[model samples]
Target chain A: MTISEIVKDILSKAEIKNIFFVACGGSRAACWPAKFFLETEAKHMATTLFTSNEFVHATPVSCNDHSIVVACSLRGTPETVEALRVGRERGAYTVAFTGDPAFLGDPDYALARAGKYMVPYRNSDKLSCLEGNSVKLFQFAVELLHQAEGYSGYQDVQKGLTVLDDVIAAARQKAGPLAQKFVNAYERKDTIYVIGSGPSFGTAYAFSICSLMEISWIHSPTVHAGEYFHGPFETTGPDLPVLLLKNEGATRALDERADRFLAQYDGGHQVLDAQELCMDAIPEKVRGYFNGFVLGSVLSDYLNLLGKARRHDRSVRRYMWQVAY
Target chain B: MTISEIVKDILSKAEIKNIFFVACGGSRAACWPAKFFLETEAKHMATTLFTSNEFVHATPVSCNDHSIVVACSLRGTPETVEALRVGRERGAYTVAFTGDPAFLGDPDYALARAGKYMVPYRNSDKLSCLEGNSVKLFQFAVELLHQAEGYSGYQDVQKGLTVLDDVIAAARQKAGPLAQKFVNAYERKDTIYVIGSGPSFGTAYAFSICSLMEISWIHSPTVHAGEYFHGPFETTGPDLPVLLLKNEGATRALDERADRFLAQYDGGHQVLDAQELCMDAIPEKVRGYFNGFVLGSVLSDYLNLLGKARRHDRSVRRYMWQVAY
Candidate 1:
């Protein structure tokens, strides 16, 4: 059976009430898009995203037989695998998304016990272009909602996913030259502040950590636009590197407010608004659903340019895969 | 009625299944400690912390009459006030924690409608000490848990709160000279990474934003220790300034792991361990409960020193109080 069929079969048997997206590092970051999808489409289902270690230590009472735990790890790190095992022990319907099914070893043994699928990507070493992982996760989420009884709008979401390639192409075309310009101007900056709101907040966070800090070795922190004014705005100055991502949603006003604030400061500030991209394929009502994907795609292109400019290899790591904690 | 009595009364009336601790910026960071406490002591209660704007826009389906919304804002900002109003409208029991009863305007009109109480503190402008707000929030959480009928160990929590003054004094005594030294070394640095896990994560976040960024105009981002090696550790070097807060809890191992990684680099790294401070008044069994408070107090002292060294007044802000977003 295909991954979707397996998930459907599992869901059909379980009386799941809560869902947890669990992983560590970039794996955890990759879960954010799916998290946003669940929040938007399946709000009735209590959903949460937790780092693998934290989840293991502070295992919520909700993580029982009535819960579904969806986790992803590119290399199937020990911590993440342990978390999935713990979830299974607690009687949760465990689902794993991974690039290398064999990386965890005893794949057949694990699959027999919990649902597992391999992410359709060959170059697992590269940090850029998480579109494949994100696509699979979002598809799984939409399928889960569709299989569930009360959830609405999954049909629109499935339709949108079918045409996401066109959206990605358009976002890349607009982001290419701008990414080069941004990379050239701020490649040497000592620090940067990346701001976003709503769905784009996860993209901002992932880009700052997975791309800027990990790939380019830059000091970048992602701040929520809605909360930017409360404290972080004080760090703004003429020399600060600020990157703002504006999404087309009800939370757009919050990003606009941050933009207005940054306009007063004579700093190196850039705003990547989702409305600027030509997402003609996605329906107007469902465009909000793809904000994270579109913004993340554009930011991923910018990060690729940054890696090229800084002479940093996206796959190179000092301690992540090298040393044991 | 006293705040504790009012909270107990409110708890008695509500059939809450889940709880949301909502606010924006520093206020949101403030809710995290209480959120952690709830997770530790009352695992049966589903709890979450969200930014006020996000809560307003993507109001969760679980946020109905079966939910309790607890929020805090020093001045009761517009976003927070709106969130509280929305919670009340949704029939969720709403509680507000603020330094001033009139800060939200028309105490009789607002508090009379939603349960509101003033945090015991004067000089609300001072950003250095958030003890009053933290104390009130944890106290409210403990009292709520105590009145919930099934939760255990509320008596120990209450006893610890009674002797918190001793903990605060001891933490300050140890933090004062160390704070001066840390500020003198890193006050001029371009950026810093504040790392913590578990209960200390909120303090790391709040100190980096509320004190370092807002008051001293420093660039710092709080990184969760469990997730630190996954990405941000790649940015570490001899010159990088890293501050780690070690809590005496199940998550302390995560912080120790980060400390070991930082040791390989000659970065201006510092660790403020809660166990290092002499807290004779706090019982050994309950020391974990006050880890957030102890670490936050010490870090706040360091921020105060940094503000003094940098000649930055904590109350002075370009936009927060002076202008609107």
Candidate 2:
């Protein structure tokens, strides 16, 4: 059976009361969009996200026969495999999303589905691909929830994704010059602070790690915009580079407040507002649901410019995949 | 009533099936240690953490009459106040841990308890005091869980804290020289990567934000040690300064693995292992419960040195209290 068919079958048969997104690092980061989807779109389903190592150490009490564990590992790390093993041992249905199917090694455990996708190019080249992976994960979540619990928002999400294709294309063009300017001005800066709120915060986090830190080998920390005032705001000054991702959602006010503070301080700040993007193709009601995708696309353009400006190959790494952990 | 008595009374009456830790920034970071404690010690209780802004935007479905929302805001920001209000509206038992009692401001809702404590010193001076606040929060969590759900590990935790008071003092002395050296060496470095796993991750996050970024105005991002290998590891090289906090628990292996990788690459890396400290006063079975406190105390020492070496007063903020966000 095809992967989607297997997923559907599992959802139909299993009495899934909760969903656990289990992975580590970037993979764990990847789960956030889906988590947001589950929380916002399907509030009835209990969803939890855990780093693989932590999950293996202390499995959640909710992990039982009526639970579904979804894990994604691009490289199929042993930790993730172990987590899946533990999930199965607890009688939870297990599923794996991977870039390399061979890494499964003929697993005997009850893995309902192993969705495989081609590995994307390494480094900054992987940014766009990672976004695609996010979409895949989000779509999978929609399908599972829709089938199991009859989530009504699944169609809206599908429509949003359809509109997002054009939205992303336009965003790339519009963000190019800003991305270039940002890269030129701050490529050599010691550190950058990336701030976002609402659903877009996860995008901020993924961009900081996958694009700025991993791909460009620059130091960037993502802070939640609302939380920025509590303590992190003290780090801001005329010299600090702040990237504020403004999403048109319930949390937009938080970002606007932070942006105003940054403006007052005259910090080297850049605002990437999803509301500024021409998302007319998407209905205003559903636009909030796709803020993650729209913002992610704009940030990817900035990351591309950064990679080009620094003359650093995103794929090249000193430790990752070059040596064993 | 005394704070502990109030806490115990509230816990005994509330039917808390789930617990939510809701706050922003530093306060949010502070909740993590207790969240870890709850997860490890009271596995039967479902615990969810949300940044105040996020929590207010979309309150969790599980947050009902059978839930408890515990929040801490030193200044009682409007966002956190809103979260507490939302929790009350949802019929969840609400508790506030704050530095200012007046912040509650003639509360009309059903706030089970408002545990007020003396506000710490402002600026870098506040860092040490914040550690005390964390101890208070953890203690509240232990007492609440012990009274409400009868967790078996309460006495062990109490024993751990008894020993931790002395351990923290010893750590301060032992960490002084090392902290001074680290400060002198990296005070001016472009960025620092702070990594920790298990319970210590919260300490790493707090130190990075409250100490390095907010207090010292340094660029530091705390990463989960278990997630370090996924993508961020690619950024590690001889140029990047890495600070690894090794805990004495199930997650210690993750930190040691990262340490080994750092050692191999010969990066400017420092390992502050909790096991290295003279924690002989803590029993083997209960030592893990105090890892966050021990590591936090040690890191606080380093923050003190960093503040001194940089000649930056933690209390001197350009925008935090000077301007409204």
In candidate 2, stretches whose alpha carbon ends up further than 4 angstroms from where it belongs are: A1-14, A40-44, A100-131, A147-152, B1-14, B41-44, B100-131, B147-149
Chain B TM-score by candidate, in order shown: 0.90, 0.88
Candidate 2: residue B276 lDDT (0-100)? 80
Going through the candidates in the order shown, the clash numbers are 0, 6
Q: Looking at model 1, give its docking quality level.
A: medium
**Residue by residue across B241-316, what tens digits does model 1's lDDT show?**
8889888866877888888888876446987888887655776665676888778777767877777887887778
- Candidate 2 residues A193-228, lDDT tens each? 889987787788888888877777777888988778
Task: Please state the error at residue A118 of candidate 2 in Å.
Answer: 14
DockQ of each: 0.57, 0.51
Most lDDT-accurate candidate: 1
Query: What's model 1's TM-score?
Result: 0.91
**For model 1, what TM-score is found for chain B?**
0.90
The interface RMSD value for candidate 2 stands at: 2.2
Please name the candidate that would achieve the greatest TM-score relative to the true structure: 1
lDDT of 2 by residue, B1-325 (tens): 5447866666667656777888877777777778877766663466777888788876666687777788777666677778888888888777776653333222332222332222221223234433455776777778777876677777777677766767778877787777877787688885788999888888888888877777777778889887887777877877478888888877888888889888887567887888888777877775776777777767777876777777777677766667667
